[model samples]
Each structure stands twice: as structure tokens, then as C-alpha cells.
Target: MDVDVLIVGAGPTGLALGIDLARRGVDALVVERGETLAPGSRGKGLQPRTLEVYEDLGVLDEILAAGGAYPVGMIWTDGEQVGRHAMFDPAEDGEEGSRFTGPWMVPQWRNQEILLARLRELGGTVAFGREVVRIGQNAEGVTAHFASGAPVRARYAVAADGGRSAVRRALGIPMAGETLDPDRALVADVRIPELERTWWHVFPPSGPDSGFLALCPLAGTDQFQLVARLSAGAEPDLSPEGVRKLVAERTHLAPEAVTELLWASDFRPRAALADRLREGRVFLAGDAAHVHSPAGGQGLNTSVQDAYNLGWKLGAVLGGRAPEALLDTYEEERRPVAEHVLGLSTAILRAEARRGAATRQLGLNYRHSSLSEETRRDPGPLSAGDRVPDLTVDGVRLFDRLKGPDWTLLTLDSGVFLVRPDGYVGWAGDTEDGLGTYRARVGLG
Candidate 1:
């Protein structure tokens, strides 16, 4: 095998996996179909949970510096501002329990830049224009054949490819979930007359037939992304002229004022999840595993997180330091989380389109597993419906003590908590007897 693991895709998911694996001193190869790193802002808004993951990867500071701080979170409206929940605000929730208080809005392009730079610094380069054409697995390892006729072997293969995943297709894996919705949303990044002090504005029922308009300011650029639900067969051009007309009709702006259309693209909402996140020695991550609506900007963040969860496990398994069962936890841990994100985003979009009741701000808490048996059970496994709590127990901040390579064990009141390498809690108990039992379960005994 030319490498320990083969990663297919060079976007945030693949690059993030590369950074994690390389930093851990693992031999991995990342391949991408694009000739060069894509240059455009597709997704923005980094969730607070993702920031904690980035912190674990040692790149949170850089991401924070490059991104814009958004103190105010998403606003829900049923024709009027019905709910305005704070997402990431330490002041609102207090210091200890506010794990992800405020989310930073960084363009996806910029985040990719940082990931690529970090990967290079760690002595790894993503091989561009390398598309995997065929993949074969044996008892010992796997071999991948690229379109360029290069054969690369590895102990494991991960499909971080996009929605149209070639590797997943080749493996005959089925993508199971809801079909793509019929609604067509027109998106464009353009410089319009200043929105003044407002950060985001949503005009509900902006058009006849329950259509709405969402205007959000883009950080680091003198542009605002306009998303409007178009009428069926409305045929709105994304060009400057079309955006001008849409803005004028939906808001107070005049058509003549909107100019400088930077980029425009149209997308249909689709929610899907791979039937299985792994197949034999091959695994899937990012859009290759699941895709959600762009309503809350969770698409990229979730996929990047999938890689973050899977990278360390793959490295450990391939390095012969952990049992093969550790890899199964990747799907066990993330599939349910993605399921929650998909449903939450779907609800957000439906509410926006139909002016329904506002759902709670998105939150993810892992409460399903043998490990949770020792601790108080959460309502259920982490869902997009629940917020992850931050540190502040027994006069210590969890993040403050959570630096370094090993998984952190944290307890609030003289107890033991086993944190998995991917940052998930494997066990938590207040008594040594309970801790010992859970520790043995996690292979920590």
C-alpha cells in the first residue's frame, strides 16, 4: 500500500481529515477531482460545536481570526419575529455552560485555505485532478484506481467525495432518505445598497403564494447574499439585472441601486443520508455520507465534522493501536447526529417557506451509547434540537484542561469521564467502581 489511508475529496471534509491524520503522524493520501482548490464561497457560518472541534484540531484561533463574529444568531419569523434565540453568547448563557455561544461566519473558501495551508505545513499535499475510478478491497487492504490510471493501495479508504460520490457508487452503496424538494431557491452574492446596521433581514411572504426573501450580510466582502423562494417557473435570472429587480420588489431597495453581482447560483433543497457510512475497509464522509438543505449553513459544517470524527479512529486503527471495532463507532456516533441535523434543517426550511412555528436553535448532544449508561441519560442521543453544554464544574473549565493529544477525562464532582479521541464522551461516573467498569468498556482499563 502506498499509504495507510486513501481519502477521496479535497474539500473541507477531506482536508480536515488530512490535517488530523497528518498531525497524528499517520501516512494518508487525499485525492481530489478538481484541478485546483475551488475558489468561491459556497457555505458560510461555522457553528459553535464545530469551533470546539476546530479547537481540538488546533486551528480554532486561526478560524476565529479569519471569520466574522456574529453575536446575534438566527431569527425565526411567522410573518413577524416570533422567536429570537441566542445561539452563541457567553454573556447570555453565562461562561460555564455556554460551550458554543457565538458562531463565526467564515466563507467556506477561506476555511479551505486555512486547512490547505495547515496540511502543507504538516508535510501533506492534496493530489488534485485525481478522481478515483475503481476501488477493490481484500482481506488485508484496499486498492484504488484513479482516472489518471494511478493505482494507490492503502489499509483503508474513505469517500469524502461530494453528493455524486463515485466511490460510493462504485461500492454499490445506496443513499437513503427523502427526495429533493421541488422548491427552487435563487442565491446570489452581490453588492447592494448598504443594509445599514442590520445583520440579517427576512421578509416573510415577500411575494404572493407564501414566498419569502432572506438577506444576509457576507463578512469580509462588500456583498450580501440574497436568497428568495421563487415561484414555480418564475425564471428569475441570477444576473445583476435579476437580483436588482428581486431586491427592489422584496425590500425598500431600488432596482437601480443593486450592482456588482459577484457570483450567482441556483440550488434545490435535497436531504439524503448514505444507507451505511462504511463498507468493508472503505468509509464515507462529508457530502458523501449525508446532505442537508442550506437553510442554516449546516451543510459544510456537518460534513467537516464527519471527517473530524472519523479521522482519529481511522489513524488509530490503521496504526495498529486500536481494535477494528473503533471504526464502527464512526458510523454509530455520527449517523444519528447527521440524522438530527438533516431533520432540523428540514424543519427550518419548511418554517421559512410556510411561516410555521419556530423550532429551537440547533443543538447537538450525544446521549446514546453504553457510555451514557453510567451518567444521567440525556433525553436522547445528541440531536440538532439540543445545545451542547460547555465546561464549568468543580471550579474548573473543561476546555482549559482539554489540551494535548490524549482524550480528556472530565467530571464535574470528583468523578471520572472518558473522552474519546474524536472528542465524544465514552464514559462518565462519580465512583471508582462505576468508572472502572466504564473504563474497561472503552479499552482504557
Candidate 2:
């Protein structure tokens, strides 16, 4: 095999997975079609749950240093400031269990750059301009053919390319989804010298059937991300002059005030999920497994967590520490969560619900999975499959104890809990009676 695992993308999902596998001494290769890392401030919001994942991956310090909080939304009408709007609902009182209570604003490009650097620090390899043309799997392993380079063979393969995944098409996996908006939307990163950076400037639609525009200052850069909804059938011009004219028409800023257009793209909001996450030795993750509207900021966060969930399982199996059947749980655990989050993203786009604790994704659990074992006759507030909170156990932070890639045996006054590498409780019992069985099943024995 060319490598133990072949990751077919170098975005956040693939790079994050490569980092996890690299740290575990797994020989994994991440291949990207693009010559360089993707650019633009796409999918900038990192949810609280994803922040914890970054902490575990050892990049939390860099992530926190590279980003800032979301600015307050300033409503504008007739080129005049009208009101101030809170972009996110404040965190509830008890939701402060984790260090992060709200989403952090880091441009997606910077996020991937950080992950890529960490992967390299762990001695991981990413091959660029190696696009996959086809993928074939057998009982022994999987082989992937690329557009230019020699085909790669590995024990397993993952498709993390993007929403329109070439690997998914080669595998013939049908993606089921619906369009959430008929009007097209344009997103761009621009430099507007005249605009103040303190607020996410918003311009509501002037009349019925018109569209809205918003300019948000990117957290770690001087560029502002411009989002403008277009009327149905309106052609989107991504040229710098076109973007400047649009901004000038929508807001008080003059066309010349738009100093530069760094990057721009257009898309229609939609939600989608692949029919299945795994087919034999090949697995799907990130936008390959599911797609979401960018409204609620769930797409990128969910994609990164997908990598976090799959990384350790891949490592365990490749190292001969866990049974191959452990791989099956990835789809079983992530698909449902993806489905639910897709609905949430669509609802948030349609204004059917408010962004609250659910969007934080801290409450996501895997209690229904076969891996979760609750031996205690009476379980407490914390149960199997739930995330183990970060508490100070005897002056030592629980997260500090659970830092490495190994499963932790956390003993509290109430009971004994086995924490998975992903920070979820796998087994909980009053004593170690059933712990042995659980350990043996997961290869901890």
C-alpha cells in the first residue's frame, strides 16, 4: 500500500483527519486538486463544539490567536444607520461548561492553513494537484486513480473533496437534498477603506421582491466579506467594478470607496446529504457526506467534527489495536447528526428557528449508537455517548487529563467513566465490572 490511509482532499476535514492520524503514527496522505490551499473567508464561524475539537488537536492557541468575536450587526436604511442587531443569541447561564460559550470568527482559509501547518508539524504529507479520477475497493484494500499521478493504494480511503465530490460521483452515491432559496447569492472578500470595521453593516431590502446586502469585517484581516442576495434570474457579476457598483448602490459608500476585490463567488443556498457515508473500504466525510446552507454556520463545523470522529477510529484499526468493525460506527454516528444539522441549517435560513444551544452543537450525543454502554442501573445527568464536560477534578482540569490520543479512564465520586479519544463517554459504570468487556470490544484490552 502506498499509505495506510488515502485522504482525497486537503480542506479542513481532510487536513484535520491527517493531523489526527499523523499524531497516532498512521501513514496517511492527503491529496488536493488545487495547487494551493483554498482562499477566501468562506464559512468563517467556528462553533463552540469545534473549538473544543481544535483544543484536543493542539491548535486551539493558534485558532484563538487568529480570530475574533462576531461584531454587532448595524442595520442601515436610506444610507443611514437605523438600529443595532445582535448577530447571535447570548449563551445561557449553565452552557458555560466548556471554555467557549459562543462561535469564534476565523476565516475558513485561515482555519485550513492552521490545520495544514499542524499536520505538517506532526510529519503528515499532503500531495497537491493530485485529483482523483476513480476509486475501487476490495477485501484487502482500496485503490484510487488520479487525473495525472500514479494511482494510490491504501488500507482505506476517504472522500473529503467538496459538495460536488468527484469521488462520490465515481462511487455512484446519490446525494439527496433540496434548494432552500431560489435567488442566487454572491459572496466576496473586499477592502472598503471608507467602511468602519466595528460592525457587520446590514442593508435590508428597500422594497418587496428586492434583496438584502451585508458587509462583515473579517476577524483577522482587513478585508470585509460582502454577501448580497440577488433577485430571481439576476445575473451575478463577480468583477471588481461590478461588486463596487453593487455596494455603492446598496449603501452610502461610493464605488471608489471599494479599494480592492480579493475574491468572490456565487451560489444558491441548499441542503443535502449523501445516501450513505460508507461503501466498503471507501468513506465519505465533510461536504461529500452532507451539505448545508451557510446561514447557521453549521456546515464547516460539522465537517471538521466528522474528521475528528473518524480520525481515531482509523488510527486504532490501522494500528491493529481495534477491530475493523469499529469503522462501521462512523457512518452510523455521523449520518443522523448530519441529517439533523442539515434540517437546522435549512430552518435557520428560512427563519423557522433561532440559533441557540442547538447551533453550538455541544449537546450532540451518540446514545443510540451500539458503542455507548450504560451499565449503571440508574444513570445521572451525564450518560454514555454524551460529551464529558471539562471539570476541575482535584485541581486538575479534566480536559488536561484527556489531552492525548488514548482513551481515558476517568473516575469520579459518582462513578467510573471511559472517555473516547473524541471526548465522548463510551462506557460508564459504578465499578469496573462491565468496563473490561467494553474495553475488549473497543480494543483497549
Which stretches in model 1 have alpha-carbon errors above 4 Å? 71-91, 193-197, 203-206, 235-256, 352-363, 370-389, 392-396, 410-414, 434-445
For candidate 1, write residues 1-445 as lDDT tens digits.
7899888998889999998899888898899888988655677778766777788777888888886865343443543455444432333444424455555778777888888888999888789889888999998899999889579999998998888899999999999877456768888877766554255766666445646776677776666777888776677687788888877776666787676787787777899999999999999999899988876667787888888778877776666666788788788878888887788778766653321111112345456643344454442342211233555667766666765445675544444556666555666555444666655554555
Candidate of highest lDDT: 2
Candidate 1 accuracy as TM-score: 0.83
Candidate 2 TM-score, true structure as reference: 0.98
lDDT of 2 by residue, 1-445 (tens): 9899999999899999999999999999999999999999999999999999999899999999999999999999998899999878868544657877789999989999999999999999899999899899999999999889899999999999999999999999999999888889999999998789999999999887778999999998998999999877899999999999889888888999999999999999989999999999999999999999998799999999999999999999999999999999999999999999999988888899788788999999999988999999888989999998877878999999998799999999879999999999999999989898899998988
Q: How accurate is candidate 1 locally (lDDT)?
A: 0.72
Against the true structure, what is every candidate's RMSD?
4.7, 1.0
Question: TM-score: which candidate is best?
Answer: 2
